[model samples]
Target: MKSTLYLLLQIFVLVIFRSDVFCQEAHKWGGQKDGTFSNPVLPADYSDLDAIRVGDDFYAISSTMQFSPGMVILHSKDLVNWEIAGHVVNDLTKVSPNLDWSSMNSYGRGIWAGSIRYYKNKFWVYFASPDDGFFMSSATDPKGPWEPLHKVWDVSGWDDCCSFCDDDGQLYFIATNFKLDPNNNKKYNIHLFKMSQDGKTLLPNTDSIIHQSPGSEANKLYKINGLYYHFFSEVKAEGRVMMMERSQNIHGPWEIRQLNHVNKTVDREPNQGGLIQLKDGKWWFFTHHGSGDWEGRAASLLPVTWIDGWPMIGEVGKDGIGNMVWSAKAPIAVNKALKIQTDDDFSAVTLRPQWEWNYQPRSDKWSLSARKGFLRLMAFRPLKPDDTVRILLRAGNTITQRSMRTKFNIATVKIDISGMYNGQFAGLTHFSTKSYCMIGIKQDGEDRKLVYSSDSQNLIGVTITGSNVWLRSSWDYQGLNRYFYSLNGKDFLPFGNSTQLTWGSYRGDRVGIFNFNRFATKGYIDLDYFDYQYSKQ
Candidate 1:
């Protein structure tokens, strides 16, 4: 049933605006520097993300599994141009000591789906781990000195969680739990728990099974127009699809609705994210495509239109469900497209906000002051000195950032290998837990050998004499990556055959500066600078 206002808006578009409002799809940059914008607001891996708009300021938080400085918080004013605001947890060890530099075992398991909401004059964030438990934090500001990660529940199996503060000041917790049966098959159930006023703990005896289905997760709750709406994702015949259930009461006789439209874009289905109603009464959904590929869960913004009290995201067809919108008007119109930092010189007292270590870093292992504008990494032995296949995957203290999807991506790093020890492997890497590729100089006794390695196999090696050498990695929009080396910074020669940037561990490929030793921790290197440049076309 269409609302009168919905009818009037369509009529207005047809009569006055003189355009088929539902003729909805276009392709270009997310922010085209014109009034228009496109899908995939970012070509980077910002997966399983949740976003909210407070006042006129929009903020988002994404899942950063096993990356130190735990959950990345992003800020945007117009919903098109985004920048890093900060991170939630500085030491992931707060979640688990295994997350500490010594253990370093929590891969693809640390932080799962979570929620961010503004409640009671404070910014609230809540998330669950499939293994560890549930956690919560609060702050006066979004770019924050967030309260130290507070473990709300120490019971595992609780996945995506959301917090809702009701009209009467009661806090509610909604999440999905994975229960393994005697057969070892998993049962999925969405549970609602009454949370304490302070958002610190779930009150005992308040857990209620609200909904159950296959693969139900990514929970979010909202109370709009006096009705309670619970949104989530479930595996359907169509694919992983977004879902919603609404009722006048918190628990009982809930009406289920599908939120997925036939995606006309390259995305499989953007099954996770948040929806917001604008101050001007327009609605927008910020989401990430659920499928993981070379580009992991790239984020896209969709316009939402409400019909008969239900929010229809993307292009609404006659059947009433939505279809993907490849391009749309900018949520907040601006002529200039804004972006975050990419190139880092390591001149700052600390790393730039875009960088994260493989896990919680040992302060003694890396430094900025030791080299006076260069990043100095002390080559340390791997925690598990045995995973010889992709040895870089097992090493600690590798600092990295997202390898954004683009028409072309080129990452170059200048290194001073004079202090390198023979047993050490230090250089530039595109590291994924499943597979990794490397192009760096290996120190064999006293000689430096230029090498190109993939999945820990030295695919090619050649003798090189250079204290200061430049290494480059380039990948096209779809092809395998190519590597090169330069004795002088100006002359780049191909190093080895191209290798695919494999995507796994629920993350896309990450550009990393890695250093680890096979024998012992006895070597070090100085990174002069890392220059990363990309083109969307």
Candidate 2:
């Protein structure tokens, strides 16, 4: 009987260990046994991403236009499944916060098209905020409290900076010149500069021209098997990806590669890409696809080959195929299958990394954790006369037409409107830059009503004059419109014409609870629960 008990104990221990391992593997965004893939691996407005592999670890950084915490760093063992490792700057003032929006700029003025490289036991990043200048920073670890900005070459209209340290430890900077012609002041060119021994500054005397495409951007340099290659985007009225190669030196008598991957056919425009070699000795290229106006861009990868010492990208026989494949298999380790959280429990110290503001965020705008399991937001004054400061929250990735059936109850939200603007309101909103729809509670005399409004100039199409109310909003892709608040959280009323507004800069619409108290005085709102149910349509 004692022998039997010992065998049973061994089985119990094995079962417990297997359960813990399963729980840990479920937190990651993807890694299913099926061959299906996630649409955007790095979701939530991340665009123009550049990634590199150092030994077994992978690191990536992308464009953060006008956002304060700029230059985000990501880590992954496999090319897929990335997480926010750290940030270069926590505050905007560190790298020029004040921006001029009237020039069609400021909103997207922070770092654009950053490149990450691991050199000589240190990780380095080269990024450009064209409005300011190009800058570089380095850290001992990929996840870092990185060193401050080391200004390299300061020139306006210079963006998408990339760097390479050659086999002999000589550093080179490859970037596009946005300056108009110094001669007739006509167009732009691709320029190269050699760096000093320390890699902190550029060598003053070593400036040369590698190639000049009138409207080209995102220039990158690579050397393989003693051959030097230059890759750039050749922007015509129609955008195209063009390549040129040289044999002798880094500064080259370069020759243009005949085949173009993006020539007004399968793809509308292909932008920046990082060329990397897999562990199995095969080459792969990662590039992005443009989404017109709604969604800024989506990333794609394609296989590349070296034929007679020249790189041939995409596949020749596949006929303009852009998705690349690397020989390295996905990492054996699994990611924790945690669902991307959108519903706020207000138990954490700060907002989730998924949230963003329309403009530069003020530190005092919102507060959390003081009230257990509740988020408190102080209303801000509006910039325009007709509008209130719409503190828009991000709608998560799971809000598809098919994913709306999952029932969520939020009837416990308690909001105090005694200190709001003369016409200020507080409720839930689904906002886009061009269009928006909201179901809110506004003061009517001395009472509150659940009123609905869309961009079509309809005010209070439906109303419920009550203090305790429940609101929900949903998108119908087939009809290309939105359905507004339901009193019981089951029935939804269509508010206006089809919302027609698609995703831009990133995917999905911005949907969250908000308060607009046009007056500058601080007023607070209490939310008990802001829950969303993810279901199959």
Per-residue CA lDDT of model 2 for 176-290, tens digit only, reads 7777666865466777899876677877878777677666676677787777877776655545554555656777677776334453223434456677787877775656654
Task: Tell me the TM-score of each prediction against the true structure.
Answer: 0.92, 0.74
The whole-model lDDT of each prediction reads: 0.83, 0.56
Q: Which predicted model would earn the best TM-score?
A: 1
lDDT of 1 by residue, 333-441 (tens): 7524457567889899988888989989988999999989999999888977777775676688799988876767899999998889978878888877778888887
In model 2, where is the ten-residue run with the lowest total lDDT?
396-405
- Superposed on all Cα atoms, model 1 deviates from the true structure by an RMSD in Å of 7.3
Total backbone collisions, model 1: 1
